[model samples]
Target: MFNNAINAYQTIQNEGLSDRETEARVLTQAARRLIICQREWAQPNLRERLGDALQYNQRIWTIFQTEMLEETNPLPLEIKRNILKLSQMVDRRTMDTLTEPEPEKLDLLIRINENVAAGLRGSVTGPVGQF
Candidate 1:
């Protein structure tokens, strides 16, 4: 699944979209999928897996954001700066959460999985326009 997402991200980049936009979309979708996967796999060890996945996804986003900021893309400089700031905020938050100790870490993962599942279910069953 990660590989497939990476391929899709690459396709988007190849099609002339700015790396920032392509990465934002890909990371958002990947994060959603990781949450869903954690909810589905709900095992005792799933918290560790979720933490790892979160770290990996954040790393991917950070790398993409860094590369995009360094590149001389045609995107407006201000927009690029904003994207970098947002990406840094996300990276910091994810890192802070993932670095929490044991039980706290587990609790965080469970809450995240539950929230994602709730949102996913709501989107699927609620009014068509709600999501």
Candidate 2:
């Protein structure tokens, strides 16, 4: 699934998607990796796999932070602030999970990734305030 997701992202990229679509694919890929790690937590290779997944997710959020912080970014100030706040939450949760290594700790990261990806794709179903 991980390889398939990467292939899908690459194919989407080659097909000339908008930036939001590319970002959505990236977030979905990250979320899928974390979901895999979470589901396989009891496997013998969990430590290494979890570390890689967490690092991958962290890198994705870090890229988002860098983009949002750029002075030329076009997002409204309120929206940028909200995204940064969410990224901060991701950062803290990531650090906590790295320190304590709990299976349940991955839920928030997964949810954030899924929600943000959905939002990027304009498929969010709930009220706007929920996001």
Candidate 3:
């Protein structure tokens, strides 16, 4: 309950931000968390926390895929398909990391999230994130 409250408060802090800003923030936050989770994989007490972080990241991608797949979504079909494929890759990679609990396995997930975030933030020139 306390954790949910904290999360709600944190979410509320970003309530007035634009959608692009929100997306960039979410992506960056997920990537940052995965980085921390990766570094702490060897700690005895961090296993559950690591799993939760992976699941959190997965949930973010799932949301993106769901939104992109909607008929009202304005993105081109090719872009939507590409995003869904990337999300699926993230899901599979997350499961692989969760199954083996390896720090090294987080590299690809980190790269994907960071790259997508960068593109969304306009730091990288791309046809991404029109939504």
Candidate number of the best lDDT? 2
Question: 16 in model 3: Cα distance from truth in Å?
Answer: 2.2
**Considering lDDT, where higher is better, how would the candidates rank from best to worst?**
2, 3, 1
Residue pairs with backbone overlap in model 2: none
Local accuracy of candidate 3 as per-residue lDDT tens digits, 48-114: 8787778777877877888897999998999899899999999899889888877888888878877
**TM of each candidate vs. truth:** 0.53, 0.84, 0.82
Q: The CA-based lDDT of model 2 is what? A: 0.82
Q: Compare candidates 2 and 3 on lDDT and give the better one.
A: 2
Candidate 3 residue 103 C-alpha distance from true site, Å: 0.6
Question: What TM value does model 1 have?
Answer: 0.53
Candidate 2 local lDDT, 26-69, one digit each (tens): 88777877888877888999988888888877877777888899
- Runs of candidate 1 exceeding 4 Å displacement: 1-8, 11-25, 37-42, 101-131
Every model's Cα RMSD, please? 7.5, 5.1, 5.7
Candidate 2 error regions (>4 Å) = 1-12, 125-131
Candidate 1 vs 2: which has more lDDT: 2
